[model samples]
Target: MSPTPSHSASRLLILITAGFGLALGAQAASHDDEHASGAHGAASSQEEPKVIAKDSLKQKMAAGKAAAKAEKSDPKAEPTSVSMAELRDLIDQKIAEVRAKQAAAPAVKVVNKSPKPRAVAMSGQVKQSMAAYGAAAVPGLPAGHDLHWEYTGTAGPQSWGQLKPEFKTCSSGTRQSPIDIRDGIKVQLEPIQFDYRPTPFRVIDNGHTVQVNLDPGNNITVSGRRYELVQFHFHRPSEERINGRQYDMVAHLVHKDAQGRLAVVAVLLDQGKEHPMVQLVWNSLPLEKEIEQASPVMLDMNLMLPEQRQYYTYMGSLTTPPCTEGVLWLVLKQPATLSPYQLSVFSRLYANNARPVQSASGRMIKEGQ
Candidate 1:
C-alpha cells in the first residue's frame, strides 16, 4: 500500500533469488546422504567373500552319479558271488571230513557153521551075516543049530529083541520052537563031568529073560580053554535046532574069559525027573517080580550041564531083535530031565517064550566030532 510499482518489482526479484538459493542447498544435502549410504553398502559387500560358479551344477551332479555306478559295478564291493563260492567250498570240506571219520572206524567179523550125522539101515543079508559072525565069535557054542529064547505079551519075546537092536532077529526070524527033541545022528560023546558046588547066587528078572548069576569061580573047559561062567538064562520052547528039531526049553550058560571073549553053552530041557540044578534055582526063587537082586545062597552051575558033552557048533546072531551077529553057539546033544513040578514053575512065569529056528542060511553047522 505505501510503495510504488518499481520498488515492489525489485523486492520480488530479491525473494525469488533467495528462494532459488535455498532450494539449491537442500538438493545438495540430499545428494550427500544418498552417496554416504551407497558407499557403506559397497564396503559391507566387499568385506564378505563372493561365491563364483567354477564348474556347472550339471557337471557336478554327473560326476556323483558316475562314482555311484562304478561302486555298483565293482565285484569286491558286493558279497553276492564271493559268499556263494565260499559256502560251497565249506560244504564240500564238511562232506570230506564226514567220510574220513567213517573210514577211521573198526571192522566186523563173522562166525562158522557145523555139520550133521547119519543113520543106520538094516536088511536080511545083514541079519544072516550077523548071526554067522556071532556064532564064530563065541568059542564054545554048538554048530548046525540055532539057540535062542522067546519073549511074549507081558512076558513076551519082544523085550529080548529090543534089549539090543541086533536081537531083532529073535522077534522076526521064523522057525522058532518049543519042539520035541526026537531026531539026532547017533554019536558017541564023553559024559559031562559035573562039579556041582554051592556059592553066592543072584537072580535077575531082566526085562528079556530070567538071568541066574553065579560067582566068578564057576567055569567050564572046552577046546582046552577054561571059560569062567557068569550067568544062565532060560528060553522057553528052546531055540536050538537039534538035527532040525526044537525043544520045549533050553538053558544058556554064559561065560567070559579074562580077555572078555564070550562063550555060551546051550542045554535042552525035557519033561521027566527033578533036575538038581532046576531044584536049586526053584528053591531060592525070589518073591519080587522084575527084580534083579540076589538071595544069600550058593549056586551050583555044573549041575546045569547035560549028561553028554557032544555038541553041535555054529555061528549065529542073538535070537533077539536087532539080532547082532558075532555069537558062537554050542548046543549039548543030550537033554536034561525036568519034573512036572519044575516045568510048572517055569511055565507059571513064561509059558511058551520061544524063538523059532532061523535058516542056517549057507552057514556051516559042525558036530563036535
Candidate 2:
C-alpha cells in the first residue's frame, strides 16, 4: 500500500524535527561539561539561551540539507523546516560558558616603557657653555698666540719673549710697567681731572686675569690729553710696587684716546674693608674660563679711586703681550680697600698673575708735589 502525500510530508517533517533536537542536545551536553568543571557560574546558565542562537540555527539547517542530499533515493526528498528556538538556546549556553571563563581569569597589567633620563657631567656642561660663547682657547693672550702663555712654567714671564718673536719687547723693553715708585722727581704736576660716570661693564675670566670691559663714557684728563677708559682687569699681588712694598692686588684701568695712544691708572688694592664695586664684578664672573659675562650693575671709575690726588707718572709698555711701548702710567699713591674675602675670591682663580717688576732703566718718574 503506497502512502498518501500528506502522510509522507508529515513523516518527513517529524524526521527533520528529531534531527534538529538531537544536534541541540549534543551542544547542551558540551556546555554542561564546562559547568561541571567550574569554568562558568550559575548566572551564566540563566543567560545562556540569549547568547548564541543565530549561529547554531544556521549550522543545524546546513546539516539537515546535507543529510537530505545523501538520502536521494526518494525522488520527493527535500529538507524539512525545523524551528531553531531550541538549537539557539543550546549554542547560547556554550557562549555564556566562554564569557564567564574570561571574567574569572586573572587580569594582565600593562607597564609603561618610557626611557630614563641621561646624566650630564659638570666639566662637560661647562665646556659646552664655553663653546656657545665662542670663547678663545687662551685668555690674556693675543689672538694668534691665545694658547701659548702662562704665569709660571715654560711660557712664564721669563720665557715670554722666547715664546714668540712678536713678544720680544716683553723681555727687552727699556721702560716697562710695575716699577718701584721711589725717589721720583718732584714737580708741580697737574692733577688728573676724572670725568667718570656709571657705565655698563662685562667681566671675562681670561685664564690669566679677570678683565672687565667697560662702555666708553669714563675719561681722565691729565698732561693736556683726554684718555677714554677702555677696560680694567685684576692681577694678584699688586703689579706696581711703592718703596719696595707689594700690596694684595691691583686693578689696571686701561684707557685710550682717539689717537690710539694708551694710558693706565694702577689702583693698588689692600686688604681692609669690602668694596661694593669689586663685589659686583666678582659675583658676575662666569664659571668657565675665557668666557665673558655682562653684569646688570654699572661701575664708576671714581668709586675705585682714593681720596688722595698724588700719583707717580711714567712712560712704559703694556704689562701683557706684544709688550707694546709708549703707554702712559699713573700709579695712585693711596691704595683702595678690599676685604680678605674679596681677595680670596680672585686668589682662587689666579694664584699669581702679576708680571715681575722690570728695571726702571733710567726712566724719569714724575711725582705730583
Candidate 3:
C-alpha cells in the first residue's frame, strides 16, 4: 500500500532530524581536534567543518536506506526514516498531483477573428476566350507597340514625328495638306470626271475615324490621269480651311493610279439638312472599334458629291502621319449638308478628330472657275 502525503512528510522529517544529530556530533569532534592541533589546524579547521558535517549526513542517509530495505522485507513493518530515493519519489508524486488538479480546470476557447472577403467566380470559357483575344488583338507585334498614335494625348499629332522615324514627316514635311487655301490663282482647271457606281461598302470605327471601305469598280479621272477609288473617311471640323473659313466636317475620298500615284478629293460638310449618302454610311456604323461592318445595299458615290463640281485644287501631302508629298488634292468649292442629329452622332464618337491646319509655305493653290 502507498503512504499518504502526511505519512510521507512525517518519515522525511524523522530522517532529516537524525541526519542533523549525526552532523552536530561530527562537528564537535572536529572542533576538539582543532584545539589539539592549535595554530597549524586553525586554517584547516575553517574548511574541514563543512566537509565533515556533509560526510556525517551522507553516512546517516546510507544507514537509513539499509533500514528501509530491511523494513520492506518484513510483512508488517512501518517506515521510520525515509531513504533519499523514497523522498525523491514522494516529491515527484506531489508534483504530478498539482499538475493533475490544474489540468482538471475549465478551458477557454480562443477564437480567430477576421473580415470576410468577396468571392469572384470565373468560368472556363471566359478564361479561354480572354487568352485567345489577347493573342489576336495585336498579332504582328504580338505585344502592341507603345508608339501607337492617337488624336489627342502624349501620342497626339504634335508628338507623331518623335514617335517613329517613318512618321517623322508628320512634323518635318514641307508640303503637308489641309493648309488654309488662301490667296490662290483662280483658273479654269481641267474638270474632275467622276465614274462612281452603286457599290457595296464596309464601315469601321478605326479608333481614329469612321472609315468606309468600298469594293473595287469606282474610279475618278482628272487631268487625263485615271485613279481608282479605294476607301474614304470623315473628320470633324474639316482638316482643310477655305479662304480662312472652316467647315463643320470633311470627307476624304482616297484614290490610287496604276503608277501608284494618289489623288484625294475633299468634300466639306456643314450642319443643315440630312444627307442620304452620309446616312447610308452611318447606318452601318460598327459597334466595336477596329472591327468592320458591311452595308446590306450598295452606295452610289455620286450622292456623296455636291451639285456644282468646281473645286480648289492643290499639290500637297497626306494630312495624317507619314504626310508624304506629291498627292493631288481637290477640295470641292460647294459644301455638303448633314443634319444636326447626324452631326451629333459623329460628334459623340469623335468630339474633335481633325488635325490643325498646316503652313502653306508659299505653295500655289488653284481655285477652279
TM, every model: 0.50, 0.61, 0.60
Candidate 2 lDDT over residue span 198-246, tens digit each: 9998788866788777777999998889998877888999988988999
What's the distance in Å from true for residue 356, model 1? 1.5
> Which pairs clash (backbone N, Cα, C closer than 3 Å) in model 3?
none
Error of 1 at 310 (Å): 1.2
Estimate, for each residue in 219-324, the C-alpha lDDT of model 3 and write its tens digit. 9999999998877888898999988889999999988777656789999999999999999999999887766687998999999999999999989877666566
- Give the residue spans of candidate 1 off by over 4 A: 1-150, 153-197
Arrange candidates, best TM-score first: 2, 3, 1
Q: How many residue-pair clashes does candidate 2 contain?
A: 0
TM-score of 2: 0.61
Show how many residue pairs clash in every candidate, following the order shown: 51, 0, 0
Question: Could you give candidate 1's per-residue lDDT for residues 1-369 as a string of tens digits?
Answer: 334433533443344334433443444445555666665665544322211121222243344345445545776754433333343344345446645654654321111211111112233343244332222222232221343333445424546555545456556554322222333334544333333467787665544556676666776666566666666778777877565666678888766555445567788898888898677787767576544455666776667776567886656655554454555566787889888888888888777656655566456555654
Which ten contiguous residues of candidate 1 have the minimum total lDDT?
Answer: 110-119
